[model samples]
Target: MDITSLGGERAAPFEPTFASAAESYLKHGGEERYLAPIVAYFGDRPLKTIYPFDIKAMAEALYPSQSNATRNRQAVTPARAVLMHGYDRGWCNFIRVRRFKEEKPKRRKPATAVWLHAFSRQCDKDGLEHLAAIVLFMASTGARISEAIALRWDEVDLTARTALLLKTKTSTNSMRYLTDEVARRLRGLKEGNSSTDRVFRYSNRHSVNERIRAVCDRADIPYKPPHTCGRHTFASTAIELGMDVKTTMIAGDWRSSSVFLETYVTPRGTPGRVVADRMNVHDFGDI
Candidate 1:
């Protein structure tokens, strides 16, 4: 019998891989080369959509109604998976791989001012004031944890009420115009009047995170691990008062701050229902 009549059809009884075995099987010219013809058979007459179905069903036989044979249980699922693999590894053009259905996203715990204040207060009361200051800076400015630890007193301008937030999680430069309250707290800190010393230089460079975690345990606030709390807090308040996304992006140095604003920092309140019962949008709403 011909190769088409033999066992060369269907899923081919093998896992798809980047190896020559899989590639040769997938290619047009080779021993028992039947993939191209089979694919053409699938594209014959009318085509069927494969999305929103499981690939397991494609291994079975076609249905009784030849009319609905074109609408069989997703014959393209295995091919789609193979295409995605190729696309992921940068081996070939697999454009159909981009057609992904987004699953229900996991929810995250809301970071609040009360929680941060409580965490900082715990640190202060426990005599770990430096770590508390770090927490304060994080909660108010939305600066990254690493950036806060790398801070030198010289980079901070107490007169200008701003911290020269230079290093960032993203490989980009940024500056923080600290909120008045947070700036005042930083200015009043008795970090010795030495311009050359790092602000938290007494401890090892790695120990900044260590002491923050230890203090968090002492403070009794939720221990979800410390990071970018100040950034979160700053974004939260700016969203509440209605700051433009462009302004926020410039201040925070976010590459796509507009996208972040829409996803994380957009206000969900209705002014009409919230204040005077009108359905008009605020100027910052589009921001």
Candidate 2:
């Protein structure tokens, strides 16, 4: 992988300032999301001067102002990108940068089936069929809104009861199961639709949120959108119904069981009772 011969005798050594490297790697290299934050932190420093400790400091600095997800994306992603860039270019050896440990946010309760039914009925009443479909799909599949919006008819396999999600946050296509309810709604929506067509047509998340708020106002239920409540509901319901962790993780496309447990799955009355009943077995004979 030596590039020395590519440039010949006049090739300069591969040394870029942090600003130049960040620009080249984050912006021009196509991960523009991290550009501003990385530049703001170490824009003027030399790339060679950056150490693991510097990354730790950057993460610490981000703690007060940003969420753990945002902080990691800002500080860690760009650093790794730059370091990997240097390695790929044959200019520097591998450098390890420690990322900050993010505290798992408290689990949000999923939207109840009752709430969803009321919301959907309200949406239909208000002529928001599209929004209702979106909510129903997310609640049924545990899909993120982005995943739902990016879905296509071609990705859905009705016979197999699965959908291939190509535009996921993980940058990898995921296969999510389709419930009978969701499949029915999706089938109705896709009637006379082409494979290339998007599943739902919407302007943006903001508009969707507004529509959801209107539906909630009419339904007389709390306005927790499917992104929060729907996903939570999917996980919690799966656990409550005794679906295994691995199965739930695969269906939801969660990378790890720990993440599924800590973030998405919130124990509720039924599961709590079951766990308590199981604990009785471990009790020392009524001691």
User: TM-score winner among the candidates?
Assistant: 2
Q: How would you encode candidate 1's per-residue C-alpha lDDT over 134-242 as one tens digit per residue?
A: 7677666667667777778888887887777665777666677767766766766745657766665534435766776676677766663444345666666666666
lDDT of 2 at 148: 83
Q: Quick one: best lDDT, which candidate? A: 2
Compose the digit string of candidate 2's lDDT tens values, residues 1-287. 56666875566755677677766665545576655766777877777787888876777676567776776777787677876786666645678876667776665567877888898888778877778888877777788888888888898888887888895887788878877877776777787889988877774677778888877887899988657766778888887788998888777778877778877887777866877898887878767
Q: Count clashing residue pairs per candidate.
A: 6, 1
Candidate lDDT scores, in order, read 0.56, 0.76
Cα misplacement distance, residue 15 of candidate 2 (Å) = 6.0
| lDDT for 45 (candidate 2) | 78
